[model samples]
Target: MEPVTTHSNHDEPAAASPIWPWVVIETLTSPDETTVVLDGASPRAFSRLNRTSVARASATAARMLGPLVAECASMSKPRDKYFPLRDDQLRRMMTIPVLGPSGHVHAVAVWVGGVEEPLPRTPIIGAIEWSVKGLAVANPAAQYLFRAPQGDLLTGHTIPEMLAAFDIWPDRPGFLSLFNLENLDVAADQWSGTATLHYDNPTDTHELFIAARAVGTGPNRVVRAVVTDITGTQNPGHADLTLVAVRAMPITPGHAVALADLKTGFIHEWLTSSPSSPLAAWRHHNPEFDDNSKLDVVQTCFALATGVRDTATHEVRVRFDPADDWIPLLAKWTLIGGGDRPQALIDVTPLAPISAPMVTGCRMCQDMANRNNAPHQ
Candidate 1:
């Protein structure tokens, strides 16, 4: 049998501390069962148990090894993983494996601690291979890794359970599986897109955004990605109204002709259209534009910034007060590609109430709208 070795000497009284304690035990593995060959510890804990067999010391630990050893043996490196004994009060155990020449676990090093306390990281028996910053062995909600198409491993982490609570999972397991390597398609340099995913229940689905960066080429085929559950934040309680479309005109210094800008609110409001204040489309400096106009002071300030544009068309024309600080706007609407923000120039002609021909045509259009929406008998 190999002699047991540890960083701390068990013989010295000064060498022992409560926070950093050692309990080394030798394991005798047979084809049938595993038992304790020796119970090694310091003056406090294991020293008193030198006479107890593995079953006498803790039968619970002896049984827990079945699952723990199986899990530790599956890992690629020599490291200890924490497994909480939920059935036992606040009790946690670790499976630290000492590797042999064949790169297989030859013996198990165990650590018993409370919920807050972690296992000692220093090597007590075998190889010093586990990362100092390695994540706790608790079962995380999700684990992900990013690699180059050529298989260079990049950044990865155990997606914390907190995110799992919000339901962040990949849609259709696009490239997260890692074994098939087809899942690698979810990432690429400078990629931004949305996909749905599942969690605890495979049938229960949620959404996530995949953003990737190509990084570089060749041996350094670096790619980066951020998979996030946007279901929580998709509606920002407001929208960032960039000047999507504009009809800039001259002749009036402070007096404007048209207004185009962004508004903030839930995304549903951005995608939907209604006749009322349409899109909460607050336009600045207009009181009589529409009865649906924000009849309150809070919106008066909002319009001063987002432009008094109707949410439906995202365009407003100062047809009411032409002589005053007049601004008029027109927008082209498409039901299919509303999400596409395009930078194209289009011509516009303002409405005039006095033009009999234009007035008649407008009245006809209004009648057609009323007829389409009128309920049938």
Candidate 2:
């Protein structure tokens, strides 16, 4: 039996601060069941005994070895000074010291549960050794090392096989080359002409064109390819002229031709019976006039040409009717890609008779009166 060390000394006033010591205690009532205790001590241990007693009240509530040792070490106490016990008792206690430097016991503790057994050692040889040995003694002729074909590792398929699977066969001669080595080295070269195919729906028209510079090596090698729909002229009645197409021509000077120019071209051919001449006198009468007013005649002419009208107040209004008399004239000469032409002479008609308004100040009235009153002038 060894002397049990205690934390207190009367000369030191017992350092009344609480001290938590980790110790495993074998109870006499249950010899097999070990209990761990967090013994709280102070210079005067009795002062806080009741509060500390609660931690030791039950089996489950007992402090375990690891945490108790940690708590003791955190307080900077020596294990032997706090938990001195015999070697045989310590062995049975299965206590492991949470050691600090050179037997300076930081904490004293035993496992409340059974001690964890040490794991057995295992021997392992790494893959690098086997790889190095295989590389050193590999025979080129026997093993076909460098000569073996390179391929997709997962699918184990060579380049030619992959191309064949996709129905791609090399049309150019000497497009694919292969090399083989016995021990560890192999190489292959491949070249091919590239082309792409496309199918368009709805229009059912096919247009193919050269897309890129020549590919592969030789006269018959494919360079590039493209396909498109060529159905623009196929359907007789289907013009495919949406409002978007009609509006695409810009009103800018350099970029777009004026409507006046369109009237001079072949557009007048479709609007009139005589392709070479303009409209006749009877055809030029105004609906409002018994004898066409000069204003009405001028208005009808301009309205026929540009799909716009000049009001009595001199403001211009756009005429949106597709069935207007001059629309046919404009449409006929102004074929889709025709360039610009003059407006006045494009579809000129003989002036009709005007009566009622004799105003000379208004341009519309003057123009209409001039046409009616001055034929030679």
Q: What lDDT tens digits, residue by residue, belong to model 2 across residues 1-377? A: 12323333211211233222323221111222222222321111112222333234312222232334443444434221122122212111133333221222222333221112232221110000001101111111111211122331211212222222211122211222211111212212222132122223334332211111122332223211111112231222222232123324333221212222123111111123321221211122221222234344344344444435322222121111222222111211222332121232222222232222222233333454556455573
What lDDT is reached at residue 189 by model 2?
Answer: 25
What's the CA error at residue 10 for candidate 2, in Å? Answer: 95
Q: For residue 281, what is the lDDT in candidate 1? A: 22
Task: Give the range of the ten consecutive residues with the poorest summed lDDT in model 2.
Answer: 125-134
Top model number, TM-score: 1
TM-score of each: 0.21, 0.11
Q: Please report, in order, the local distance difference test score of every candidate based on alpha carbons.
A: 0.30, 0.23
lDDT of 1 by residue, 215-277 (tens): 234333333232333434342222122222121123222121222111211011121122221
